[model samples]
Target: MLLKIGLVVIGVVILYVVVQVLLYKRDMKKTKEDLLTFVTKNKKDVSVTIIENDDVVLEWNADQKTPLASTVKLVVLFHFVKAVSSGAIKLEEKVALSDIERFYIDRTDGGAHAYWLEVNDFSEHATLLDVAKGMMQFSSNACTDYLIDRLGLEKINDQMKQAGLTEHDELMPLTPMILWSAYVSDRRRDAFKKMSGVSEEQYKSLMNEIFNIMKNDPEHKKALEEKMKKKNLLGWRIQSLLTQKLTKSTTNQYAHFMKLPG
Candidate 1:
């Protein structure tokens, strides 16, 4: 009687295991179908992958190139962390805010997201750690520009390449200010050409010169402003054009820097 009861228990356990396996397979099939349907309906050019226990479970266009956007900041942070480890930059070292960096705070516009430090949070100065935190946490472009200046771009690029991003070109050469300036210059190129009577190349050079003067020489900036005002060329709606060009990224790429558990 005892032997028969033991056999019945084993049969019940086997049935339960089979049922669980079947349910799992059904759920997986539904998940795949749903994902494919959504991607098809939305017409999204995306890559999705699922891995389990060192195995590729599902992949759809996983090899397609996707723009990293602010995700590139992870490379910057990776280098920054390395520099700190190598005794190149001290964590407590203070980074002073430039006039342009402070513009986000001074301007009443809702452009900057003060995640870690306000305009006056540290009185025109924040520690390297604070800047790093701001760059990652707030995605502050200005903070990124400052850190890039502190840690050479070439070093960051080398670090990224060594870490298996060898195929990604044009990922490390741009700083936040450079990207912003490029975007603005592209938007204003036509207007600048009409105003200066110069070719596209010449117009870009002149814009760079003007940008330098505005950032460095206050007297020259005032002169340029007065000249524009006198010539009635100061009323172009450049800001609206900028709005059209500053496209936001859909995903958070900064999280790529984190060392995940295996």
Candidate 2:
């Protein structure tokens, strides 16, 4: 009788394990199906990665290299946090408003340029955390531009390279009209003057610096190659243009545009 009772207990435990395993697999299948359906319905090229209990359980790339619209803000926030943590930028450090940030605010709020704008009165004060929050929540152009300037484009690009996302691209800040025109037309020469707001001589010098860096960096070269291999022809082309410091249309002409390079 004792032996029979022990066997019954063991069989019941085995059944419970089997039931749990079956339920887990069913849930996973349902999740994948739901994700695929949503992507298809929206006609969006997106990549979904799921982690469960510290393990990656699902990876679906509708279009992995496609430029993420506002999602790139996440990368900007990531870098901001890193910079603060590393003591490269102090959280309490005050960054005075530049012409760029002021311009953005004026245009956004329909304020006049000649009007006096103070830090507390100028619509907003830009702190380290405020910048990060702006990037993450609103994907604010002014906030992103400010952060990029403070952090250095090269530093951000390097962090992206280290993160293993190499296909992301960035352009220098430009005027709204010029930026919009470039986005619409994808013309480099016409927008060059408008975007950089510098003399031709200065622009030429800046281009040379960017070219030297791209020409010398092995990781950048490899990332471009990998992007090409993935059949992201537009992305490959955009990287080439950026390396040459040639202004293109909108930055998102290619598919995914992550703030970090993959």
lDDT of 2 at 195: 39
Worst 10 residues of 1 by lDDT: 247-256
lDDT tens per residue, model 2, 130-208: 4544443334555655676677767876875566555555434321221222232344444443434556566545544
lDDT of 1 by residue, 54-104 (tens): 556767665545555455666676677668767787878877765436223
Scanning candidate 2 in windows of ten residues, the lowest lDDT window is: 174-183
Error of 1 at 79 (Å): 0.6
Measured on C-alpha atoms, candidate 2 has an lDDT of: 0.45
| Number of backbone clashes in candidate 1 | 0
Error of 2 at 116 (Å): 19
Candidate 2: count of backbone clashes, pairs at least 3 residues apart or interchain: 14
lDDT of each: 0.50, 0.45
